[model samples]
Target: MKKTEKIITNKIKINDRFWGRYLEVVRNHVIPYQWDALNDCLPDASPSHAIENFRIAAGESSDDYYGMVFQDSDLAKWLEAVSYSLENEPNPELEKIADEVIALFGRAQGEDGYLNTYYMVKEPNNRWTNIRDNHELYCAGHLIEAAVAYYQATGKKQFLDIMCKYADYIDSVFGPEEDKLKGYPGHQEIELALVKLYDVTGKEKYLDLSKYFIDERGKQPHYFDIEKKKRNDTKPFWFNDDYAYHQAHKSVREQKEAVGHAVRATYMYTAMTDLAVKTKDESLKKACEELWNNVTQKQMYITGGIGSMEFGEAFSFNYDLPNDLSYTETCASIALVFWANRMLQLDANNKYADVMELALYNGTISGMDLDGKKFFYVNPLEVQPEACEKRKDKKHVKSVRQKWFGCACCPPNLARLIASIGHYIYSQKEKEVFVHLYMGNETTVQIANNNVKLTQQTNYPWDGNVSMIVTPEREESFTVAFRIPGWAKGTVMKLNGEIIDHIPLIKNGYVYINRKWQENDHIELSFPMVVERIQSNPQVRHNVGKVALQRGPVVYCLEQVDNGENLHGLILPRNAELKANYNPDLLEGVVSITGDAERIDQTNWNDSLYRPVEDKTTSVQMKAIPYYAWCNRESGEMIVWVNEKR
Candidate 1:
């Protein structure tokens, strides 16, 4: 079996108009602000006693443990973001802070390698007793990820060693062995993190442990049930023993549709793909493919958001996506990106990369405000401040981003993803390099026993023109594949100032260019950046007669600040001439979509709840901004889907 290839995070440097600013915000603003939030220094926001829990466990503070049981994962995610920031540019103060945190972790860890501040400080004897809801293993998984990332970024092994010890302890407690407890995480994360540990340490036990967790899930006489029975606790399960909520309903190989909590489902799928590639498990690979098709074809939003309902923060029936009541949690989309990238590794298909890019540009980044200090846990397609405030069903929807949350998972998750944006741009095999995303960056890839330097310059998402220069250490024949996005049409290519008149070799979704490279060969690609009106399938009842606006990879939304107070009453004409204009002075410089449309006038209703139907209409010019940039200015009603006057 071929070894799975990974992008070396430290080798790639991002410098793009779209992503560069996000990276800078993650480094300079989000990271420091989150650090303060973790330390409980932000008096204006909800208290996050994450760091204090650690201090209590380390015996540095005598305070009682406060916050959610999963609070420790917040710090873990922040640490992972810090590692990525340090990889982009070193800061001594940040490093010192991370180092001090690591020292505290060492002090907090028990002699048996048991870690997790919740159990350590609050319930010492109850460790591993409630794997169903305690989130102990889930927290451990995040800590392991932070450890691996920090070690990779700074060449520091102390954090890694601490996590390894903790992992070893976990490995001892749960496995197929008669003495070990047969349990898996209710929240599936440690399985994926263990794969990262195995990649770095080359320890087969880590890989085996990850496989054990995946294989043991959803088996007969489920582990959650067994654990519950052993405790003899009569409390009803929060999910009413709906094992699918945790994705533990059946074996992973037999599960076809995406079910359960959106984040947990995606995380488990990511680990399954990772293990399938590593161990050459054909069944696992097939299961992943079926699940992938189910998600992207039936369950996904146009913005690549998942998890339709807020009831369980989980997926609903197929094509049941509601524009206003959607609970597209930010972390779910980020995890979707993670799963998609791993799927790309398993197969260099453009479908995965396309969804990855969709989530990055629209759903995931929409969770964070432009300044990066504020964040949204739910990325709704349409929002009305009054509805959110007055309606019980719309209570979860927020028209504006908040400073912080008591749950607080999405903020740090967004931070780490934006900080590590370089990892998604390009991937490599022994002699093949696949460009998954069009981001301006420079990086070196080892191909065919030689170093190849590649630099890309593009104003993607705003303009579709891309220019690339390839420089290898010496003349060598290799293949470079550029992804032709699914949405892009009438693409043109030029190699070294000469047009390729003949049909180019296209595979999956990439144009393949294989040749013996010279010192400074140039490649240029142009994709027609035309505004498109997208209509949902008839099965999606909510969007049947409506259309959404999209240009390039960006999804556009109509805001009250630009359109009017009643955005829902606006109707887009069937033949409206939609134009894309780059407004540097608006919404932090976005290409806004403008068109002449009509709105139903409600001026003469005159205190009547019900009135005779009439076409009391007025002409208005509609403006749509990038979905990610909405609500960054004034707070008002926002709608992605506009009624079409067909």
Candidate 2:
């Protein structure tokens, strides 16, 4: 089995106008603010006390354990983000702080290598007793990931050694062995983290354990059911015994559709893809492909958001996406990106990179505000402040970003993703270098026993032009593959000021340029940027007669601050001349889409419940901002799909 190579985060330097600002925010603002939140230092925000739980479990603090069962994972994720941020740009103070946190982990871990502050401080006697509800393995998975990332960033093995001990302990407790308990994580994260641990330490046991967890899930006499019987508890299951909620209804290979909690489903799929690549498991690879198709085609939002309903924070049936009541959790989309990257590694196909870019530019970043302090847990396509406040169904939706939430998973997730954005841009396999995303950055890749330095300059998502400068250490033969986005058309490429008119070289959504003897080669690509109106399939009942605006990779939305009240009443004419204008003064310099539309004049309705069919309308100019930038300025209603006038 041939495995794909990943570029270390420290090797790539991002300097784009768009992502560069986000990276700065993650380093300067989000990381520090989250550090404070973890310590319970934010006076105006909800208490995190995640750090305190570790202290209390370590006998360094007297406070009782507080917060959710999965609170410890919050610190784990934050530390992971800190690892990436430090790799991108070194900071001594932040490194010191992260070092202190690692020392805390050392003290909190038990003699038998058991960790998890919630169980240590509160439920020591009941450790691993309730893997069905509690996120014990989930927290361990995140801590292991942070440990791997920190070790990769700083070459420090303190945290890595700690997690290795905990992982070894876990391996002893659960497996196919007769004495070990036959249980897996209800949350489906450790499987992927184990793959990372294996990658770092070359420990075959970690790889085998990850495969064991994936293979054991949803088997006969399900583990959750067995555990429930062992505990001998009469209480009903929290999710009403719907095994699908935990994605345990059927074996992984037999399961066709994407189901269960959105984050868990995506995370598990990511790990499955990883194992498939590492072990050459054909059936597992096929299952991943089917699930990937179902997710990106039938059940995904236009903004690359998944998990349609808030009931279980899970995916509904096909084409059941409702904009206003959608629970497109930020973490789910980030996890989708994770899964997409793994799929790309499995095969350098454009299909995976397209969705990865979609989520990165729209759904994922929409979870955080421009300033990086406020965050959104549920990213609704359409929001009304009054409906969010008054309606029962829309209660999960928020019209504005909050300081912090009690659950507090999405914020740190976003921070780490943005901090590690460089990892998604490029991938390599042997002599082939694949450019998955067109971000402005520079990196060096060893191809054919020669060092190749590649630099990219682009104002992507706002402009469609990209320029690349490739410099190899000596005359070497290699291939450079650049992704031609699915949304782009009439793409023109130039090699050293000469047009490459051959179209046969483009395959699988990428244009391949193979040659030898390069010292200062230059490549230019142009993809004409235009405002386009997109319509959903008729099966999507909510968006049947509506159209969404998109320019480049950025999806646009209508906010009441720009459109006015009753955004639903606005109708965009099919023939309206949509124009894209770069507004440097608005929404942190975004390309806003403006067009002509009609509004239903309800001024003289006089409180009538029903009125005669009158086509009384007024001409109005509508302005749509990038979906990610909405709610950053004003508090009002926002809608992505507007009524279309046929």
Candidate 3:
């Protein structure tokens, strides 16, 4: 059986140069800042009203509910982040606050295990009536996730039991049975959350409920259609009764192409993959693989972002990625990571981890500012301040990150993901320990009757020199697999100080070192980090003549501040000498790539918007920063794919 269990965040002690800072920022800055925002106390930030709704639902206040239907998720997600932070580093005060909130949740929950603030506060009798457009199940999913995290971190069953009661109530309400509602979430999240609940409590019913939701989605007559007909009222549903936009146009097994809201699609696919792996269902597994390939090979941007168009925040078509008009929501990119990580658990494929790394380093990190306070809900590859200001359609493309969002999903989502990033670094099977991602960390793994202590040191995603030390309680024979990233070529692994003469075993982009180890045995792996030019497929019309820069896993982009405005006019020379330089003062000390390029003197053409091709150009020195590090400095145009001299 493949390894389905991943190492938890608490086990891996991160002390690295790059990712450690990010995690620390989440712990110290983002969490507190978001806590204030959730309480509607953050200065100059959009009001969340997340806490006020709970107070109203709990009968602590008579004030009406405010914000969207899914406002509760902001607090739920924040609780999840708090749980992870508890595991990373215990905060008694924070835990006390979380406990108080959980108590409020218990108070707000109805007599029948229902726990939605909007319905409880205003329309108590009309609960679960509009699951298609409303986000009841979606909010419940976040609550369940928080419950599981809190249970795992603090070993407290208060929140877990509250959510489980809600889940059991949900199970009683909807299913394939004749008396059940036969309904699922329009925004697909509870499906995956149920799987997590089952994993934690060993409860078969939660797993069965998740399977029922997946199996019922997009089935004949369409549950959403039936529900809508029953209501017979029009209130402008977000998807406009279009099943494709929510990925409910067809059954899970029949749907092949990636479609719908990117976040919803990825979250549903994650649950599907989890169920498939747990049940050993080959057909369902194949469906996940098909969708995975469709997204990564055809629909995904070079920065590992999805949701190409702004209209629906959805997948448009194959090779239809646009640079400027993109709606790559940070939540969508995070959902992509969730799905890819689950796929890795099922198949142990490097392709999935590659996408995970791409999304983590670029799309996910770019959602937040360097200061960890401001956030970008939509990440665009190309940006022009003028276009953002003047074009009504491009208004979502902000030159700077915002203080808060009305929806307010991405910031908290980023917080939880970053706080729990250690969970994605490693996994374990029967006798093998898999190293999925590299960073400075110390971890202990239990293999059968033995405890193994392993420590790793590296500056990854920037440099590729990793040194690992293995110390088991006793001499034990087990396999330790280190992932040789797909982007890495000419990788070398050495046992102790000398290179082993024996041919190393390689599987799924990992080199397996299985041996009976002593207390202080050492392993070193090196992958040369070189700046490589990446070009899109010829089918991708927008990027046919352009190239993106990549060093290791970090994608680099050209900013107008370094190359002057009108970034589209800048072109890379055929023999451009690109070099990486570590600048301590810029964007918190990133390794910026410097090179020489040419620019057309288009300023001379004062009156002509279009003219005959002229061979007039000027040589210019250009600098490129990590895609995640862009937009941190002065607002200017940015381009990941630069025009290359033919």
Candidate 4:
């Protein structure tokens, strides 16, 4: 029997409350508030404005052409969201709205090939001439992803045909063949987008093109610079972006640390992982491993944030994790999830999932406000609102989420991530289906030419009693791999309501259960949610005197608004009794900590920098919320890691 045929996969069906949160945010907040704010920020006199941009530089224009990048990505994200919702609720209103949004996008794509507004509207005579900077390829990448997602969601081919034309057009433009001009996307997303195109159409060309881009990238005789010379590369693609980080000195894997444009680096790494998985290339896989180690071990924040410096908005140094002035972009964290999840597929490692979970819980989710209209570009851990203003060099580190942004990356980026998250749940090779994330959702996927229904039932990240029911097409023995989270201390697995004994729960950081599953076989996993105090590695000097809290996947932090007075003065006194409570009335829905943080008072009004008055202890109530939800409430002080009260 085929592997997928042997095991039945069941899933936990996600209702509106589960899957609709981010989508609802997109519909209610993103469209009306942020998108317009972004459009308003763009220069009206510029050639790239809404009316005259990439797609129709030589022909008649459509509103759909102008909204291609945002519209296509938004449609793709909405399609995913609505499909998940329809699986459970099947709302006509949402379906109608989603259909309309996709309909306009479907109409905008040209017949022979081409879908960009700037070209169609502004300079019809100069479409391909400005491929380097005009976002022609970037637009194609978004449309390709949109086509795949929309096709999967509704079995609609209207937009898919359009993207096929666009992809074929782009594929024709760049390749490994001589005289083909070995050009790659300077922004680095079309590679991953091409993978999505291949997945839907099963066309070897799309996959081949994606691989060519990955192989051609970072090679000597740099394609970007070569293309620059051809176009007279006047200002460079992103005129402001100096091509310092896109090219590589050695091999792609030899590149040790993250460099150059923050978004470009992350997007390239994401595509590399996609290519690695598709081709099963060990060298590419090895490169991904080295890069992951560099990010998590050294260039990562305690709150799972990345990009310590704002200069290029890229990673600067290892252990250079600054709190008050950190440009940990919300989009970068989203990209980290993208990279980490891809790494998870290339191998079965707890560490990959660990970083993914960290980014999702803290860095990624921190992008949006509770109401969803506002968004944070940078998620800094500690905020000295007073100290923040004096820093000239750290201007990119905005402590609060803004209504909209000029670059406008994080909002739509977060939307797409939350929408396509089902892909991160499980992975299957032949016989074994590996369960990765624990969410209350049900999913049906084909493996080994057999249908597997995976139904999960649990309120994860809050409580860890996860029960999975898997059903196979035919009874065949296969190894079912369940992830044992790195944080899981007392892990237990049960089969058919009976506890299984003598099976290893931890192996290379994964628990494997081999069994011949029937039509309905229930597997229960208990991941004990223990309150763990997280301290930085000894190498992190600044975090030595402080400790953060974590129960399950959430990293907790204390803000001055809730604690009152000095946030630095607060601490947990000498192994104080720890308590956790779910405060529904707090910021959205969050777990709040109210178990005594000792306060200190210093009355050295005359001191300048060091010398202070006697340290006097003052016991006070300190409440801690999820680090992601902290800054949305007030403009006061906030701290992620706090002084330990001894």
Write down the TM-score of every candidate: 0.98, 0.99, 0.98, 0.87
What lDDT tens digits, residue by residue, belong to model 1 across residues 210-279? 9999999999988887888788987767775588999999999999999879999999999999999899
Q: Report the C-alpha displacement of residue 582, candidate 4, in angstroms.
A: 1.6
Worst 10 residues of 4 by lDDT: 1-10
lDDT of 2 at 265: 96
After superposing candidate 2 on the true structure, give the runs of residues whose Cα lies further than 4 Å from its correct spot: 1-3
Per-residue lDDT of candidate 3, residues 52-95 (tens digit): 89999888998878998999999999999999988888899989
Clash pairs, candidate 3, are: none
* Per-residue lDDT of candidate 2, residues 492-595 (tens digit): 99999899973889889988888994887999999889888999989999999999998888999999999889998999999999999998899888999898
Q: Candidate 3 or 4, higher lDDT?
A: 3
lDDT of each: 0.93, 0.93, 0.89, 0.69
Q: For all candidates, what are the clash counts?
A: 0, 0, 0, 37
Q: lDDT per residue, candidate 4, 1-646, as tens digits?
A: 1111121222434532333465566555554443344244424321223323322333344444444333333334334444443433456676675566445544555665766655655455665664444566665676676567656656668768767878897777778777576766655677888987887788989989988876776677766667667756556445245454553434576677776656667777888888788777888888888888888898899677888777767776778787777888887898888888788778878888888888888888788886777788888888877676778765665666776554556766776666566666777767767777787677776656767677888867777889888887877577778888889887888889888762555565777787777778999989898778888887777788788888888899888788886688787875776778876677766678777667776554456666545667777777888888878777788888888855
